[model samples]
Target: MKLKKNITLGLFISASVTALAWQQSGKPESFAVNGNLSGFNDSIVYLTYGTFDDTKIDSAKVTDGKFTFKGRVEEPVQGMLFSRDYKLRLDLFVDKGAVEVRGATDNLKVAGSAIVNDYALFNQEIMANRKWVNNIFTEAWNAKQSGDTARARLLEADGNKWYAYEYEIRKNYIRQHPSSPISARELLMYVNNKTLDECRPMYEALDAKVKASLQGQELTRRMELLSKIKTGNKALSFAQTAVDGQTITLNTYKGKYVLLEFWASWCGPCRAENPNLRKQMDIFGSKGFNVLGVSLDKTRDPWIKAIEKDGLTWTQVSDLKGWNNEIAVAYGVKAVPANFLIDPSGTIIAQDLRGEALNQKLKEIFK
Candidate 1:
């Protein structure tokens, strides 16, 4: 009982320290970005709103290889450091103060401990893991470019190794920073990935008084998505109006092979793949193969026009909600040209088929 009490007390102290650090926020902050530039003098930096949007350079600087950012950022804004079209890296989390980076950082080495407040120690762990992920991403990209397909596959087996790693870090961080919404959300996101059987006691830990107190807006949505995916409970069957004004549910084509395609009207890759898809459709459309396109678009005119322009005569459907569509949330669709090919019985057999490989698959299945 004494050891248990000591553990509980220690946790309380850690949570209190985190809360105090974050609560005393709302002060002006600055960041000093320093690094080496081979020869480039003028570099523009930008913050991307979403993954697939135009880059807007809110801050401009001339680099003698080192630059400083001295400004105040509002809470919940994740800091992104960039140089021209080279790479955009998630540098640090700004709640209401200045955090600094003191070295050259691509997407991989962005999380170092140069300029951070004394309390959280987020910069250290973030940097360590960022380096690991950067190594993985670089290795994967290089292998793929070098035509080393097997090597790339091994390096990039899971696209989400960082998320899972963050879970463990956040779990330990939370014991010392219970009042931190950021840490709490991070923990919940990781827990949500686990089985309900695994997370049951963790949820139960916050059963009554604590659950209501932990309010995380962004964290809440992420947690919900993770929960849904873990459970495999279909929120609603994929339903949309066909181009011919007919209703279609993804479930309607359940017994046959189906590909759930998330794409957009303005996407060049999706347009380029249309011809290959058309050929595949011609061969396999009658052989228990179908495509259900979910357009990540806001307007109907361009969406319809693109379908006609690409000669995509498949059953295209969307709620016309663009990125905010609930279906995108339900399936965890982050980027465009994403696809999942379900087998005849509706299990995900393959994904992201394009180019000659797609043609090869059609030949194998249809022959």
Candidate 2:
């Protein structure tokens, strides 16, 4: 499965020029941002506002160690500011009002908005915890390279512990601050990691306003889609272009036990699992077992190379859109090396089977 990536926190500040008409609860008619960066002089800073699916982006040039952006937003929305090189990023909750961003480029301090402050506080804790986790992983890697298996395992365990601790902190924050916009954002993080049964209570506990926000709406959509793909539900039907430039659909393999696999060329764990998966396919291929590989690769070359190198003879398909791959999104696949094992009649019998578990499951099913 794909590990979580670093989150970019983009921020912006502006001076009010003219008021634009918009209304949000307890917010102003117009919003202004004033940003001061210590080391970023005469550089361009870009600002983007809204959710992942819908966003408005604008850029301003830094002059005299500061930059400004003024606009009107209907409600408080997620906003990001990043430098041209993308080395600096600040994320905040943006609404119509006088918002101020100041401090070192790497450690921005946001003020003048309650939601923004709430997000900042929450983001700080997450970033700190993530840094610690990264350090642990780094040490683990070093230990592995030096052939210190015991130290590496200990460090890996520590990393996982910290990761779970961070998740709990986020969960608790959401539970404690149901009204804060950050709570909705935090809850969205668990969409892929937690099941519907585990997440429904937290989602229902959110404030009505928070639930109606953009991130909340996205979470709701994910939940609705996930509900249809539970263990007992039939696998979602989808069509994608195969590596040979032909169209393929899930129904094409209806008569066999199919493992609908989501993977990517760049995913290390996916590459590592390919050999084992290939072995399983060999033992079961003649017995009506098949694999439908759906790649999340953004480009064609590496995908082709990986397949050849791994000896993956199964049917492969992709739209070459990376994480936004059409089939991947349809299946609600948040990570690579994820799969659903479907029976001959197209019912999902099992999911996320790997290595010996996969081998054992197939033996039990066909024996």
Q: List the residue pairs that clash in candidate 1.
A: 14-176, 29-98, 30-98, 111-127
Write candidate 1's Cα lDDT for 1-367 as tens digits.
0111111212322334434334323443443433343344556554432111222235656566555555443233334566676454544444443344444443233332222242235545645565666667677888899999987887787435663664555565555554444443444445533343555444444323224322333444555665554423433366677667787876778788777788899999888888877877788888878888889988999999999888888888777899876667677666678776666565555556778877777677668
What overall lDDT, based on C-alpha atoms, would model 1 receive against the true structure? Answer: 0.57
Candidate 1 segments exceeding 4 Å error: 1-20, 24-40, 47-57, 60-77, 87-90, 101-215, 226-232, 235-241, 244-258, 265-289, 298-311, 319-321, 329-332, 337-367
Highest TM-score scorer = 2
Error of 1 at 345 (Å): 11
Superposed model 2: Cα runs more than 4 Å off:
1-30, 84-86, 134-156, 244-247, 264-272, 296-310, 319-325, 334-337, 354-367
- Backbone-clash count (model 2): 15
- TM-score result, candidate 1: 0.54
Residue range with the least summed lDDT across 10 consecutive positions in model 1 = 1-10
